[model samples]
Target: MSKLTIKTLAKELGLSIATVSKALKDSHEISTETKKKVLAMAEQLNYVPNPYASSLRKQKSKTIAVILPEVADNFFSLAINGIQAVAVQKNYHVLIYLSHESFEIEKAVVNHCYSGRVDGVLISISSETTNAEHIQKLQSENIPVVFFDREFESLEAPKVITNDYESGYLSAKLLLEKGCKHPVFLSTSLSLSICSKRAAGFAAALSDTGLQTNNYQYVVDCTGTQEMIFDQVKDLLQKHKEIDGIVASVERLAMQIYMVSLSGHINIPKDLKVVAFSTLETAPILNPSLTTITQPAFEIGKSAAEVLFTMIEKKKHSIMADTTVILPSTLIERDSTAV
Candidate 1:
């Protein structure tokens, strides 16, 4: 059988195409009686409105674009779930894109938003995003955007962030209190704002403790790779054989640190202490419960969406504000960093 279209539904109900469209959306402009009739006929005719047709005329897809560095990580998976929950509640659609931590990919994704396929955007900058021109451009076009987690300092937009700096400080201080003299910081991005803030917090803590703020003390400009990180950890271990502690910036990197310790026969909290910034549900079940500065990831997503919806409303001339929101991160003390 041939598929049903808006015209078929409109003709059957003796209504205009616009009336049928408005009824389907349950727009206040469409009367309740009309809505009931249109809905009944639509169901009977199996009429499926072309989203693209509506998108073109209304300039609204009712969709939000979510751009992330990667979704393989549990934090983002949870964040997406949170964002999805709000989107569904607000009757908005979600289109996800992964930059894989590539700034160029992030820029391209932002550029694509000019197509008006989404009402607004939520982004976590990639590790390599040094400039915010592309993001600023989107803002200029009146496409209100919100940043969650990895945010840009240049853009004056609502940012939903964790307490990365304080969390880093807390994690590092915990390791030091546990008697780890040479606590190397493992991180993914030196260019990204979140990692930089975290590293700064750690360095501040180290300096305050009278630890040599010397060359070997602060290692920056590291490569991003499991193999590279493993080799770097090995080299750091070899240099400071007495190196007894580590503060990993990302969750996945912490796993690698754990693996390296195993291969080298280093015991946690005995020969070594480890801490990480993570939101993984599996953190507690690791070989040893991992001490971590856990981000309220779902809350971050929820807050980001809440802010984005507000911006979207502003764009639509609805009542709302274009304010920035930042969420706090929680530090969970686990056996891995216990003294």
Candidate 2:
């Protein structure tokens, strides 16, 4: 079969080439009825417009990039689905980049995007990201960026985030109410905004309970491989018999804690009550049923995509520095934190 193009459709429909082109581009200059007719004929003729030609005429790549720390977890996976839903509706392609929680990789991807490979970017920054220079450079190149899930608070860009501070405070408050005196918050990073904010919220809760700054130990920072984190948790449990509660900043840490507790023969709830910020589908089916501060992963992703598209429409940095969307998270009680 011959390669079906716009010229063939125009010839067969008895419409001018200009008219067919405008209709295909959805230009308002063409009437709606004309557009419908042209589109129907093009479909019947199996005419496929050259994407490269279309993009060249519009000066747009018609593609967006999604930068993620990792997609192995449930939260990011759900978030991707939400982003794709919006991208499909807008007839845009999505390019995915995984930074693997490394700042260097994230920076490299940002630098690549600066070449105008994508029209816009949606990012969940890596835990090790401190310098915003790489991302700022993308803005300098006229590419719009919106952050979701993880973000740099200092960056003056739109962000879609969960209520981490409130969720952390409430998780700690619940543990205290359940008769836990020495609850510890666990984190994989010392610099990540989400982890630090959650820790601050936990500390704030303790202060509200008349605990002095030095009266109670609150945060325990752990990093490296899963075995290393597991070892750190074990050592912590070994050193502090009074540690009766745990607030994991993320879900993987919560799982590590559960494993450490089980191996060491420590009873959950009765010994160490636990809660975590998680989007795990298995939270309700864990051996003891894990308690969680569940974030709206899907909503966060969807909101970020919508904001990025809005910026894409402006074709420049139209995002207000103060523009932020904070979705609330829910603390679901389970056997892990049963009183």
Candidate 3:
């Protein structure tokens, strides 16, 4: 079969090449009815637009960048799938950049987006990210940005996030209901908005239970190398033998707790109940079947992408006026947190 082109679409529809071209670009000059006909024929013929020509004419890269802290987490992997689903439908390409949980790396990645390489950006801020200057700079360059998961609360960009505070309260409440006397919250960064919210909720739960948060609930930083984190967990368990339950801010910390418990011969639920914010598919298969506060990762990704494309297509200066969408995280009970 001959390569499909706008000329072929024009010839088949008995329309002028100029009309077909304008319709393909969704130009206002083309009537809605005519645009539909052109689009339908294009779809029927499996026509693929020459992105290079389109970009030259429209000054768009026909691509978007997704900057993430890391892909090691199941949540990020699922989110990527959701982002890609929308990108494919819009005939846009996705460029994924990982910051590896480093502030410098994230800043560098954000800086690279200023080169007009991507039409828009979707980002989940790094745990170490404290400054919004890089993001502000990206916006200054007219690149629309949508945030998902981790985000700087100060930024005016649209954010798609889960209800971290509520989820934290629920997780801590679950442990307390299980008769936990000493519970701890583990987080990588206290500076992160999500972590702070979750930590606050965890503390609130303790306060409501007639327990002094200072005595019963403490937030432990688990940021470092795998070995360092493992050691931290081990030390935490060893130093505080009274620790009856743990609420991990992220999945990695939860896994580390499990490892520490296994090596230390401290049984889950029996000795130390564990819960975490996770989207792990293997949650059900873990030895104790991990309990989790499962975030709507995929939905968050899809929503962020949709909002970003809306900004890109409409040529909006900022989505600051757009309301932030906060989805709830579900608390799933399992053997790990079983009474």
Candidate 4:
């Protein structure tokens, strides 16, 4: 009924406790033959070392923490897969945390990394995250961090991002050519760096084509559940008959627009055209097919882990990685934008 301990191993192997301890640590003071014999006997006795004790001795947790806004989205889900793959290769365990798009939750998650329970971190900021102080505080403690997909402004760290602004402009141009006169933007946070850049590019594209913001008539600000977004879409169409096209910043809201159009008897392409920024695999299979700006979610995640590992192993100094790297988004044209 007693648990395994170093003293027990020392007794079973007929060695002093200090020798057993040094052998387990593979210290230079312990002979290789002694280490092999001690380790073999310890394994036979079902010995399991205390992780906290090991961490304290080695100054390494052999673990990485991954924090994201939400894992419910397909993009984030795939990103996690990539992170796990790299963690497996490096023999590092991962602890995942979700912020659910709340800035307060993001602040708390970053603060926890100060405990040194994890050796490094990878984060994707929440929608409401606008400040960089929380992330900077972690870096100050020498905890290496890499940002994937989303990030905070003014943070001096390695980042992985997609070309949001160009993608947004391209999507808007596609909608414009599809004969949409009044296209409105639907977004979660126009303040978030990614969302704001995309919106600005979308606006620029509209202006270049001679259509002003007021010409769009209305931009329906949708929030909460899928059902709630659908209702908001319905209300927008009712109140603003001139809204004939859409630029959805998120895929979930874009799907809701399709649902609302079906229930309200509005025809896709004929009455309304849509373009969305999404990493959905089902884009080509939607009712009339769907057009989307797809980001390289998995690639970004893989690159982030690769970069973080370089920093973790290069202990004397952190990585002097290029501050920001932007991967281009691909716009897939489909029936959703047809006229």
Candidate 5:
């Protein structure tokens, strides 16, 4: 049998091609009864509307891009699931890109995405990204961009993020309450805004206890492979035997701390109290368990997707400007931070 088309439906229903087309699109010019008739006939004939043709006519790809630093992170994995849920409901496709923590790679990806490929973009920038020119260029081209999780604060764009600063304060407060006098703030990158905010909060909490700036340790610029991080953690622990508390800004660092402590025969919460911003499913099941400041990653993803779709469908790119949605992070107390 020949493929079904709009004309075929129009002919069978004794309607004009324009009328049938308008009816199929639920155009306001078409009466309700005519729309019902067109829908019924299309359903009866098993006619599927050609999305490509519709896209061409509407000047839309019906797609959105999700750019992330890494997908292996449990937080991002959950966020992707939430993004997919909304994308499927809106009949939109998602194109995922990873920057792998490289700023140059992230800029290149954004440049490539500006080629009218996707209707809108959602991004969680790389750790090394400090410049916002690439993202600003996309917004200037009328492509809506929403930031989630790791974001650039200087950019005048919509952002969905967890309360990193508050969570950091809470994590540090928990450790201090547990009798940790010398807590070290561990982070992979100092350039990341999220890391900075968390470190600030941790520092503020430590300051509340009348600790001097030098006494409240902030160990930024930690990166590289697992072995490198392990070695770094070992050296740091060995050098600062009095560093009774550790606040890891990232989950992998927390794992590294756990591994180093075990190898060194250091007891968790006894010798060193550890807390981290983590979304690991094994957090509760880890050796002695891990205390975590967990972000609402799924909700952040869903909200960012929703905002992007609204901009795409509404044709209003400026809707995302200066908009910020902050979600709360929960501190899950586990055996790792027990007194």
Candidate 6:
């Protein structure tokens, strides 16, 4: 049998191609009776609408892109699930791109999105991304962009983020209240806005206690290979025997601390206490349950996706460009930070 097409459907229905097309789309122009007839015939004939052709006609790809630094983080994994939930409900396709924490690679991926392959973009930028020119170029092309988690403050794009600063402050206060005299902040990226905000809040919390934040050696940058980070953590623990508490800015740093403590025979919550920003499912199952500042990662992604679709459907860039949605993170206490 010959391949079925809209032309065939129209011929079989004794109707014009335009009429058949509108009926297939359930356009209001087509009466109920006609739409029923077209739909019945389409089912009988096993006729499937070509999404690509339909998208071309409507000038919409019916697709969105999600770009992230890496998917290895449980946080990003949960965010992808949230984003996918919205995409499925909207009957839109999702394309994910990973930049592996490279600014140049992220820029290259953004450049590729300019080819009209996607209707809009949702991005959590790389740690090394200090420039926003590539994102601005997308805006200049009239493509809507939504930022989530990691974002540049200078960008005039919608942002869905957690309260990093507040969470940081709370983490420090929790440690201080637990009788920690020397608490240090461990972060992978000192330049990233989220890390800076978190570190600043941590410092502020210590400063409020009359501890000289400047002389306390409060922030430690752990950006490097896994081995290098482990070595750094080990050295920090050895050199600062007074460091009784730690605020890890990421889950990896927290895990490294655990490993270092084990090797050094340092007892958790006795010799040291630790709290971290984490979405790890294994946190509770660890040797000592880890205390965590858990961000609403899934909600951030869902909100970002919803905002991107709204921009695409309504073309309300002016209203959404300056929009910022701040969600709250939760502090979950566990044995790791126990007094």
Which prediction has the highest TM-score against the true structure? Answer: 4
TM-score of 5: 0.85
What would the per-residue lDDT of candidate 5 be over residues 98-161, giving only the tens digit for each residue?
Answer: 9999999999889878756789999999988989999999998888999999899999889999
Tens digits of per-residue lDDT, candidate 1, 155-269, equal 6777898888888788888888888778878768788788888998998899889887575765434456678878877677767776778888888788877888888887886
* Candidate 6 or 3, higher TM-score: 6
Off by over 4 Å in 2: 1-57, 212-216
RMSD of each: 3.1, 3.8, 5.3, 2.2, 4.0, 3.1
Q: Which runs in model 3 stand beyond 4 Å of their true positions?
A: 1-57
5 against 6, candidate with superior TM-score: 6
Candidate 3's error at 328, in angstroms?
A: 0.8
Q: Give the TM-score of candidate 6.
A: 0.87
**Model 2 C-alpha lDDT per residue in residues 1-339, reported as the tens digit of each score:** 348877888898899999999998899999999999998998887787776666667678889999999887789999999999999999999999999999999999888786547899999999899889988888878788999989988998999998888888998999989988899999878698889989989999988987554865689898777898899999999999889999999878888999999899999989999998899999999979999999999989999999999888875465455689999999899999998
**Between candidates 4 and 5, the TM-score winner:** 4
For candidate 6, the lDDT comes to 0.91
Worst 10 residues of 2 by lDDT: 314-323
lDDT of 6 by residue, 83-172 (tens): 999999999999999999999999999998884678999999999988899999998888999999998888899999999999989999
Rate residue 287 of model 3 by lDDT. Answer: 90
Which consecutive 10 residues in model 6 have the weakest lDDT in total? 209-218
Off by over 4 Å in 6: 1-54
What's the C-alpha lDDT at position 72 in model 1? 81
Off by over 4 Å in 5: 1-56
TM-score of 2: 0.85
* C-alpha TM-scores of all predictions: 0.88, 0.85, 0.84, 0.93, 0.85, 0.87
Each model's lDDT comes to 0.83, 0.89, 0.90, 0.84, 0.89, 0.91
Q: Answer with 1 or 6, whichever has the higher lDDT.
A: 6
